[model samples]
Target: MGTPELALQVEPARWLGAPAPGGLALPPARAGRGTLYAPRGVYLDDRVVVVADSGNHRVLLWYGWPKADHQPADVVLGHTEFEAEGPGLLHLPTAVALVEGRLLVADAWHHRILVWDDLPEGSGQPPDRVIGQPDLRSTVPNAGGSPGPAGFYWPYGFTYVHGWFYVADTGNRRVLGWRGVPEGLRPADLVLGQPDAYSGAENRGRGVGADTFRWPHALVGDEMTLYVADAGNHRVLGFTPPPEQDRPADLVLGQEDFDRDFELPHVPQGPQRLRFPYGVALCRDYLAVADTANNRVLLFPGPPRRGVYLPAAHVIGQANFAESGENRWRAVGWDTLCWPYGVWGYQDLLAVADSGNNRVMIWRLRRS
Candidate 1:
């Protein structure tokens, strides 16, 4: 596939959290509707926008796409109010998604997934169901026991596609999938990166391979293809026809091969290499990766063919493909990024969870 004829604006069209003005200093953590602190995940569409304000241990929601910078969120989750911040329910929510009108949150620190039957209209709305734990109040790694199909340990990201729900069970170093929004305490139908549900070793307790992950942080795809950001391995792995069970990936990105997982010394990196890539999203035919440690986002023309190393068509949050620095090794700017952790592409808009900068940016595709 070729790179699509698409371009993203150098600056975001709209943003939430941090003030728009650029600077070199890091912003302080604040709790309120218009502020964010080390946000780790984001979801966007024409109807709604969700941000995982991880530092605040809460999730913020805009009933609709915001029209201004630092717009206040319409609803708050994981807490009773925006200012009350003493670990109410969520320990550190890292991701959010909507499936069939239901809201799903990856309450990462608590090691569970929270599901709300419908979007809540107010703050502190408890989830209708919970996953990874036997009940809502029980929060433990692998349910305080060995790893299993139904347990999670720091499950940081997830997605719903083709009626199936997939989760990046990070601490377990694997991915778990269910046929649909599961009820309660039901085991996943499929597992990836491990020999069985009971295994949770990094790279299967050995070296890296096409079928193992060091840190499976985020994922996106459909029934045709799936992409996972293996952050700890510094690469993204692609699975064709969506793996039905543990299997080797059909493609690898950010490195020359699946066995290599080294992070090059801080310098200008080639388009084909990635350093701690943490997020992946598909926009039309293009793939957007949050090259986290590189402090930028890489956009591939489209899904590359089965190959070891593939180059990206464009780069965002930096001056060029060769530059890899947090805010370009200087002050923060509208076009710069600092350790972006999540990305979402819909139509022509790209939502980025700029984690290090404590903000979420919404960039638009530049029309020719």
Candidate 2:
């Protein structure tokens, strides 16, 4: 079947964290609902929006989608107040998600994931449970020892789908999964990229292949497939039936084959190649990938076929597929992006964590 055609607004419909007009020369890094600093992750749904303001070490939550640009968040996590800064309960949070109405945040520097049984209604609400550490106060990587299923080293991204939960244990060079919401520091039921839970070698200390990964950073999937952005390898891998154990991916994107991880020249390469792709999301009939190094996002038709060297059907954050410069190497504008780090998509809205731009841009998507 031919790929479905998709269209996106050249400019964002709404945005957050941009400086006020003529306010500052650079994007502000202050601690406030309307401000952000190098946000690396975002989660968007029909009614809510969440941003991992990574540089500020907090997560901002809007109870409802912001109706205007620079709308202040209604709640904040990881800090005591919107005006406060520095690490409090979170340390460089890199990702956020909502699972069955519960909140999950990847507190990357803390080497853990925090879960809230219920969504917080106000700022400073604490997580109900913790993962990857023995307690909330412990921040050691892999519990201060070798890699293991019960501990994590910079768990940067995660997703929950089909009653299963998965974490991109980035620092460990692995991905971990549980059958359900883990209650404590329980060992992961499945491990990928590495051979086993105790192994943390890059590409398993060998050449890159279908089963190895240098940096497994982000994940998104549906009931039948799971897609992972192996950033360090400069590709994305798709697993069918969401493997229950170590297995080679069934599909590869951004390269000619699984073994070749070479990046194309920095010029306007077509959509078949990727460089440091850090995020992936399934937006209805399309799969959106944050091609981080290219400063753009690629949209592939959904139900990604089992193959290598797949090409994207469309591109975002740039004027066309033949462009790959930050803000197109021009002045920042409503449609430009720089080093976008994360993406989350709902039915018709696509949210991008435009990290280098220090803002989240929400674009309207339409099918043709």
Candidate 3:
């Protein structure tokens, strides 16, 4: 099969978190005018666009589609200023999700998830609740250095769908789910990567298998399917109908089979391989993945409708799959990417968290 021909390009020259925006400019010594540093999380809906400004230890919220580059965000979370980084503030927050009038943040380094009921109107407001730890001041994994249903270590990303809440507990090599939005450190009703909720071992402290995960970093889905970017395992796992309890995934991408976790050692680079796929997004008939270490994003014309190996129909950042260099070994531009880690697609718009570039690139799919 020929390389899939789904063409995409940057939508606007105005990039979010850029320095031109007011109030959060980085110091002169820094590389860019914007304050973002290694940002890894992004969420977009009809009302707003939210980004986990990881390096700044803050989150930026834009109330609507930005009409120009360097537009200022409407709200800031975790700190009053962008340059400040401290405890009791977000530490490498990697994901953001808003549901049911509440804002959710995966404060990864703090080993907790923070909740804000009714989005804050400005900066420096504290969250209404904290999950994974007993309180906002405690950063201990599992709240005291042991694994249980309520604790988390480096929770990287999350999603809320159909009244259920999910988190990619990266450091623990698992995924946790709640029947609804969690109010506190309530025990997860569902767990993946181990036999039960209490186990936090890598790959369940066993060899690689179809049922285990090394680093499950992101979650995205609709009403019928849930996709996980299993970063450490270099693959994407798909669960049809979205598992309500611990169960084996029905579909796998980036490898020939569930047991094969190694990257392809040969000539061509194509859909059959993935190197640290850190994010996934599914739209009507499209699937996009942030192939992070590979410095590219892979796009499929349609999600796997069955359990089969389907090659990527298109690619972004690099001319083709065989090339995997940051900015394709050239100066960074709107068309290029470096270590891109998050993807959000809604309707015709697709947003990419271009981490190494310190900017979010929005693209629109070209109609055939």
Number of the predicted model whose TM-score against the real structure is largest: 1
Q: What CA RMSD would you report for each candidate?
A: 2.1, 2.3, 3.8
Model 2: CA > 4 A from native: 1-11, 20-25
Would you give me the overall lDDT of model 3? 0.78
Model 3: how far is 195 from its true place, Å? Answer: 0.7
lDDT of 2 by residue, 1-368 (tens): 12343443333688889653432244677888789999999998876799999989999998787878888889888887898878889999998988988889999999989989888888898888898888887899997788988899989899987888989999889889999978558999999888778899999999899999899999998889989999999999999978788899999999899998998867777878899999998876788999999999888876595899888887888877888998887756677788999899888888999998889998877644
Q: Model 2, clash count?
A: 0
Of the two candidates 1 and 3, the one with more favorable lDDT, higher being better, is: 1
**After best superposition, candidate 1 residue 87: deviation in angstroms?**
2.2
Global fold similarity of model 2 (TM-score)? 0.95
Q: Model 2: which residue pairs collide?
A: none
**Model 3: CA > 4 A from native:** 1-14, 19-33, 86-88, 264-268
- Residue pair clashes in candidate 1: 3-301, 23-332
Quote the lDDT for 21 in model 1. Answer: 52
